[model samples]
Target: MKTLGIIGGLGPESTLDYYQRIIALYRERTGDRHYPEFVIVSVDLRKGLDFMDANDLGGMANYLLESIDKLARAGADFGIISANTPHIVFDEVAPRLPIPLISIVEATRAAAKAQNLKRLALFGTRYTMQASFYPKVFARDGIELLVPDLQDMDYIHDKYMNELVPGKFLADTRAGLLAIVDRMKATSDIDGVILAGTELPLILRDPIHDGIPFLDTTKIHVEAAIAHMLS
Candidate 1:
C-alpha cells in the first residue's frame, strides 16, 4: 500500500474523521488489523479561515501549498485536502503541487453520477457553496448543483464555523439544518443533497434521509483515497 498524505485541521473534527475512517476502511477491506502507513499534517485552521475571511483564496492556496510541500518532504505518495471549502483553490494549487492531490469535488461528482442524480442541493461553508470548483466539475457530467438562499447560506456557514468546527453539535443546530433541507426540497427539484463540508456528516451522517439522498463529500473522498492508496 502507498502512503497517503492528508492536509488536515482545516478544522480539527473533520480531520479526525478522515484519520479514523481511513484506518477503519482500510482494515475492513483487507482485514489485516494493521494500520496503514500515512502522514497527517494538520495546518493551522485560523490561517486558512483568515484568508477565507479576507476573500483571498490565493493566500489560502499558498497556505495549503506550504503544507503540501511539507507532506512531500515527509514522503507522502499522494495528498488530499481534508476539507471542502479550501478546494476553492484546488485548480490553482493542484497543478503547482509536487504530488497528486485528490479533490473532494471531483470525488463527489463521480459518486453523484454513479447514483444518476441529476440535480443536487449543496450545503456547506459560504465559500464552498459559492465556489466555482464544484459547479465546474459537476457541469462536466451535466449535473445540476443548487445552493441554499443567502439567508440559509449564512445560517449554515455560521453554524458550521461556530458550532461544528468546535465539535459542538446542538440539537437545535441539527434541527435548523434539517429545516433548511426541507425548504430546499420545496423550492427546487433536487433529487439529493450534497454535504460539501467535511464536518457536515458529523451532524447529518445518513446518506438517505429526509426524503433525499445526502452525498457525504468526506466519505466519497476517503473512499477514493483508499482505492488510490491500495492500488
Candidate 2:
C-alpha cells in the first residue's frame, strides 16, 4: 500500500479523528500493531471557508492546492481532504494535484448507494447543505438528500463553526441537533441522516439516529481509504 496523505486541519478536532481512525483501521486489518506511513498537512481553513462564504470557489480551491502540493511532494501516493465543506471545490483542486485525491462526498455517496438508501438528511456547513456537491452525486445514484431549512441551516452552521470545530461538545447542542433530525424524520420519509461534516461524529457518535442509520461520512471516508491502500 502506498503512503496515505491527508489534507487536514480544516478543523483540528476532526483531523485528529481521521488520523486516529485510519491508524485503528489499519491496525485491525494488518495485525501489525504499527501504523502505515502517512502525511498530514493541516491547512488554515478560515480563508478557504471565507472564500466559500463569498462564493469564491476558485479562491478556495487554490488556497487548498498549496497545502495539497506539500503532501504530494512528501511522497503520498494519493490523498483525501478530511473535511466535507472543502470538497465543494474538489473538482478544481484534484486536477491540479500530483497525487490522486479521494473525496469524502463521493465515498459517502457510494455508501448510501450500497445500502440502497433512497433519502438522506444532511447536517454540515451551510455550503455543504445548500450546494449541489452531495446532491449532485446522490442524484446520479438515484438517492435523495434533504437539507435543513434556512433557520436550521443557520443554527447548524453556527454550532459547527463555533462549537463542534472548536471541540466544545455541549449537551444542549446535541439535543438541538437531534431535535432537527427528529423533526426531519417526522416530516419526511428520509432513510437516514448523513452527518456530512467530519467533526459531526464527535457529537453524534452513535451508529444509529432515532432508529435510522447515521451515515457517518468520516468513518466512510477512512474505511474507503483503508480499503484502497490494502487492496
Task: Give TM per candidate.
Answer: 0.98, 0.97
In candidate 2, what are the lDDT values of residues 100-150, reduced to their tens digit? 888898899999888989989999998899888889888998899999888
Reference-based lDDT, each prediction: 0.92, 0.89
lDDT of 1 by residue, 1-231 (tens): 788999999899999999999999999888886889999999999988899889998899898999999999999999899999888989899789988999898899999999999989989999889888888899999999999999999999999999999999998999999998898888897899999999999999777776799999899999999999999
- Choose the strongest candidate by lDDT: 1
Write out the backbone clash pairs for model 2.
none
Candidate 2 Cα misplacement greater than 4 A, ranges = none
* Model 1 stretches with alpha carbons more than 4 Å out: none
Best candidate according to TM-score? 1
- Residue 169 CA displacement from its true place in model 1, Å: 0.5
